[model samples]
Target: MAEWWRGSVTYQVYPRSFQDSNGDGIGDLVGITARLPHLAALGVDAVWLSPIFKSPMADMGYDVSDYTDVDPLFGDLAAFDAMVAQAHALGLKVIIDQVISHSSDQHAFFRESRQSRDNPRADWYVWADANPDGSPPTNWLSVFGGSAWEWDARRRQYYLHNFLPSQPDFNFHNPAVQDWALEVLRFWLERGVDGFRLDTVNYYFHDDQLRSNGPMPTRDNRPPVNPYDLQDHVFSKSRPENTGWLERMRALTDEYPDRTMVGEVGDAAWRNVAIMAEYTQPGRLHMAYSFDMLGPEFTAGHFREKIEGFFAGAPDGWPMWAFSNHDVIRHASRWASHGAPDAVAKLASAMLLSFEGSVCLYQGEEAGQVETEVLFEELTDPPGIRFWPDYKGRDGCRTPMVWDASEHGGFSEVKPWLPVKAPQLARNVAAQDGVPGSVLEFYREMLAFRRMTPALQVGRTRFFDLPEPVLGFARGDGLACVFNLSARPVVLTATGALIDGAPCHAAHLDAGRLLLGANGFAFLRPDGGLGLSAG
Candidate 1:
């Protein structure tokens, strides 16, 4: 690729909920193809689809049975080809999600591997002998609840699973496993995919010794509902050998024209950004992102640290930033106390687009979509059900997209996989499609502004020393981006002429000061000799 992703915007489409054309209460490839116009009109540079491979729906398709074929639930290989063709026709790059770290227990490779100790594929997955007392070989814990090691009755041994028991971690130490992964990428490259989004990219390897993970330091009084967050996780993941496997993946992607890859680095907040930096070093992944911006922290220092942390760790590496995705609660709902729903949504868009890297926008975000309140009876996500009231799981964020104000929000004719409530459905596309001051329109305008501003796209970011709740930064040379992170108005003293900003009650310039309304923001170009400070 010619560095197209450096400043591009990608919109994620959760295929299971984007639209259901067949009315089977599930979305398909054909539905996505029909909705291509929505993405094209939204002004995003590319479209990223969640997993569509043959899966048993374990961990919501993160557990794949066939790596090279599309699930009939999504559509056949032909349907995938058609979707790619349509996306390309609309001038959009297509990036598909790839789960290479593990495979479903029902996968042919894993099935045969577990049948016998000496089978040809027995070494394909991480398998170990139990202790004298028949306990697990190691103390690793699954990202889901319970032990990471599962007992196999046939082989009388324990197999490691970083996720659910149905999802077995691949043995990256085995060279054959690496070769097969590359082949799988090659199969998709031949089919004309623009790139791949590697799921749980850093969880590809484990310590050879299979040593136990140590406890992580706690800094709070609140107890943790999930014990997975209580460990150092040094031996279980973030292995040094993952670099070699990433190189192999990069080399394979380099074989095709204009191909790219973005890996998801899931780790401790302290190390995830650094790991993402390492993964995107020379001869590896094109770009990498973490859960830093996708979490509950929304502060000036938090955003600055993450953006500057990636560059500080590896000056030459590239990082992709996102505020929401299929995982975590939507930012609007997560940070609800900061400001009004619409103001917070629009302000977030301006900040994300103004950041100095590639960006990804989740589905329904353009409509200012909030997380749905999924009841226990309607929960389908594994983690949500395992830890019921304490953690409702990701089903709230994975609900279907809202396209119109009509019943089901134009997502499907039959009852969809997830419920579409009135609060979120009220913000549908049909209502805000062409209306000015709407979140959808604001996003369209903000994206257009980012495209014309080279400084915002690929600029050196430097923060202004403003007080808390007021964020200020410089993109390139003259573009000054500022935002009020609180619900109350804030003022800053600056001797600069008001040059440019998105049309909104977000902010304004006065005699010698900048007055920002609640959740207000502005983009300014200053004259010579300009200084900014809190008023």
Candidate 2:
């Protein structure tokens, strides 16, 4: 039987920031095709492209207008087809982003829905009448900022948008809407795309009663980060109705052999992991990712708690883990003071590869790049614009990938869409290429190591009883793995020769315990088990 996607590695490529083949200062499909060899070299099984479909670029490419067609800014349908064909030829599966929860205001359905209150497509979106005082129907807040409902003068009512106002949430209650979204999926499936990365997978439904969400009781005694997180957000998103739609999506993808779907469930609470367990068991999504590791907290205890919580909450649901993405601060920048930036990057790669689920390696992370600092004048993200000084928004992480230290960091002939910060340039791929111990090389080695070790790739995990700042876990078939996440050395009692890195050597077990230096980890097995060797 063919194996499921449980232990796969997916490389996420943000199209606009990846590479520019046309010298237009924006990355496109052709650029992606040009870099296919790079992905193949990195040894990832799949590439998850972030929204190359037609869009107004309001929320970058999340506000898609034409789901079936490729954006002219990125490339045309033919270029997409060529890229898909090339990826398959190179043995790399291609996964595209599916933003079904909302559509750009420029979308035909949204335009028709907003034209009038009784248009044929009027109910295609979530529209509600204003309160007697003419306020929004409910106190929903947009993730970007302000109210989630935006007034439409033509309809004389409000339409809901969980994100920016330009992105109107689709009325999944409408069968027509569901059919249309499925058709969008079929379009790509027909084009030979491998799978989909569903954006905002849990926000597909709203409370039918339109009830207001109650405020969250203050627990930490700290002020709320943003008003959006202060409410329970129960009635607004993560409704029970979402599971049915997910099943429908699963059925659609099931028609294609070997196809997969990974949903982005954004709830910071553990509820998102529970929902992921519900949605991806056997027949729903192939896997799901959350924001648990995306935040700034980087202690060993925090990492252990997050992973253990997910495993406990969603015992059967497959998960996808990532250290950096387009939306938040890079891990190197977030956890810099605790460990050396480059060392942390390598350590993260090692730790993530050892997990029990699939992994997502974001672009530019292999180079040990930290988050770029974007000044207010250079900011493009709406969230940054809304919460300036308080929060710099996602533009820092969304900056163009630096391939070389040359002009524009070799990302573009003209200035890229986002400025390539000076600090990031020093960590470009060209600067680290062929360097024996560079972060990029470490990533390549770790990925190669994962592919060769079936236990690392697919084994069940059992965490060890380790102290704070020490994350110890054993993962493999009859193998015990342990890691020390702190900066100090610790002694461990083991009866086998230590094996680590390439050209494995026999470590002298001088005493009953072995000393692990700060930020150190060990993979030990019994003397009679599989002998230690690095791939």
Candidate 3:
């Protein structure tokens, strides 16, 4: 029988920052292969590797120039094949990042598309003529900044770029483009990859009318760091055409046994979850993740709302939860007000693992790594460079992973692509490896606990209605589990005896009086009676 992905844990590795094998200051396929044992020991069932495809590094591999080959910077195709074999040998499934929504301007299809109006691949990209006034035809804006449309002097037209201009959006409306993209996906499937993590999954198409988007409502106005956020984005992305293509993608994946696809839906609205539900029901993506929990929201109510709302929107569609990733501030820094970094990190790991769907653990998160402050001059992410002080961009979170306290934090023999700050060095893997109760140890124990407990691994969740700042939920295959995210002692009432608790945490079930300490959680079985109290 095929196993469900829900309730599984996936470790995400940003290839560029994971490790440097050849001491080139950049991580590569061999480096990732060398680290497979570490990931396997971390207890993750799967590893989601960021893009390592051939690219010009326009958007750091998000702009793919070739779909079937690895970039020389990362390694050759043989290296990728070796990594895949090694990962599978360690019982770890491999999911590679797939950026089908757009391709580098240097891609053969895009290059040919731009060369002649009558070429076979001419309509492979989203190209439109400029307005009579010599301006872009629409009001769409690029996520990196400025207009999403870039004028192409050669074609006497403007090309659409949902992200950086170098990443030109493909014309999903064109049948040939869809076939080409599907072929690229097939190439990976044939290479024995387990699945894909679709980047910007919703940006595959645009409104064909080229109509300007209307002004975003006042409440929606955040900052203007990315001009794309200044508009409603109705005509720019998340088009209805995307649904059909998603179905097609799903059908393609279904052809392979046990294969999966998890999409990264980059919208801020709660409705994004609903769209994910629509896309993944029966035959679309196997799962989808949003940016809801990645923000500064840390209260129990915030997490409760996000999870409950997601489940409500897509009861059947699995969700992939992550508190930190390559694109945002580390959770320790984002939720620093909660308490000590280690405590918050442990609490987050516990909470995320207890959720009803799949979970993603970003690299370095096991070390309780906080966001490193990168100055403007050292910034490598274009978004951060564009939105300087207000939004420091992602470079802060993209710092190289620290393996030891050695120079360069043992990430590279030479200086790394991104500097490993002193504070991060202190939290390197070697420093925390054997320490009792260290964040890394805590993660290992938690993951091991989840693996042992059927409820945590494959049970259904029933969220309990508890007081504010105290989020409570029950997960069991006939047993009950409860959690309190607050820092204050609270009374927890359950039906049965307390069966287990996390490391360094305790619970008691004497005469129906349950006492849960600050930031504590408990696992229990029903006592068959009601009216329990912690006091």
Candidate 4:
């Protein structure tokens, strides 16, 4: 089987935001199938659909209620099958999100488990009695906020919910639960889906002893916005026992041809790099990604450290790199101060794609999409609604994708699930289709450039000892890639014949000294001696 994901680019489609074909004001499977040609034009290797399984929309499909069926909000299983077939026909692989860490409280299994303690599925979920004083079993906190435990009056017990109270974590300690989770993967694989994007891969297991997690040290001295960040999270997630379950998942995928799995290690306290390494070793996940680059850290040193740290820790393990996704603020807006918006978007695409591993691009990233300012009443994300104003949740980044500059940006005939604002509408795909120097065009050009260059695709990376604001690295011995992470121009003396540069930014190699303008970048052939200039 071909390892198609290595060094490939996967585009993420948030189902509710892509397009609404039925005029239901929400995107669905049919809408996604109609957009496969757009992804093919973008030149991505695969398309990753966010959670579309049956749910009550509490966490916007992340809180799955059914493992085998598609939600009516996103269409039925037939729609999902049609979408997968179309994607495969276009030579683009289909990867769907598997949120098995927890399920909606309304799920039949959870409903049964929460019933009488002697029920057949009673132990399917993590359930425990409260402390003598009637407090939660531990200091564990939910990612959304508040205690991680929810009281169940029927069983007179508190169930563990790492997220919303409506979404309860599964008790992986039970061998039967692991078997059921593996069957969920088999169901999708038999459906013709190419791979799986494991959601919260590390949260599959927890300390069986219910040990309390102490406070973990923070690199930055900034105050915590969410109490969950204050605790160490050692007992809540990233447990060593999770690896055995990963082996089961990997074994199931290995049974299918050309199937792959990329796990999302949402570990902050334990430093995701280490967990990514542990989870992706042979016989486990094919690749793992973390939120290290999803935050507000935009520096050459920061990028170098993360890439270097992963390879140093797990030389044989593969990793996935992504700048922005559905769960966080868009990168274009987060790092806007680095340079012009369009320039930064183009530069970020070039830089992220040029890295040494597989890459994932969120919807509308090709058009340099920014976050929408959602009002309190319009907020749909649980976290944003819980912690309003200060942290306006993920709805900003999860706004509908702008396809055209129509009244609703062509996403829907009616208002979308999330409002489509003016600022986002201005950067629609129709506006940048063939425009010169446009962010969309830049993405197309950059993705094509990466496809034809073997060095940029699967080459080994070696960092240069260049000064700050100018991050330089060589991709194998064939290509040398450098970036200007600041808004000020910088020149570095280097010896290499330019292969691809200047077209990306106002940069040139003259007299062995490369002069790069603000937010500039270059790809050079170290062995060639040809000269290049910017006119």
Best by TM-score: 1
Backbone clashes counted, model 2? 1
TM-score of 2: 0.95
What lDDT tens digits, residue by residue, belong to model 3 across residues 69-177?
Answer: 9999899999999999999999999999999899998998888998878998888899999889998998887888888889888899899998888999889999888
Candidate 3, RMSD to the unseen true structure: 2.0
Give me the runs in candidate 3 sitting further than 4 Å from their true place: 220-224, 493-495, 501-511, 528-535
Please identify model 4 stretches exceeding 4 Å from their true place.
218-222, 500-503, 527-535
In the range 1-535, model 4's lDDT, one tens digit per residue, is 3898888899999999998999999999999999999999999999999999999999999999899999998899889888888898999999999999999999999999988899999999999999999998988999999999999999999999999999999999999999999899999999998899999999999999999999878779886788888888999998989999999999999999899999998887238999998888999999997678899999888889999989988889889999999989999999999999998998899899888889999999999999888899999899998888888999999999999999899999998889999999999999999999899999999999999887888899988876678777888777788888988888777676788442458677787878889899888877642223332
lDDT (C-alpha, whole model) for all candidates: 0.90, 0.83, 0.83, 0.90
Q: Point out the worst 10-residue segment of candidate 4 by lDDT.
A: 526-535
- Predicted candidate 2 versus true structure: per-residue lDDT over 1-535, tens digit per residue: 2444679999999999999999899999999999999989988999999999899898889999988898999999999999999999999999989999999999998888888888899899999999999999999999988899999888889999999999999999999999989999999999998899999999999998999998866679776557888878899998998888998999999899889999998874656667777777766788888677888777768777777777787777788888899998988898787677777777777788788789999998989989998999999899899889898899998899899998799989999999997899999998788898898988888888788888887787777666666666667655565555656556666656565553111123443465656566656664432222121
- CA displacement after TM-score superposition, residue 376 of candidate 3 (Å): 1.3
User: What's the lDDT of the predicted structure labeled candidate 3?
Assistant: 0.83
Deviation (Å) of 383 in candidate 3: 1.1
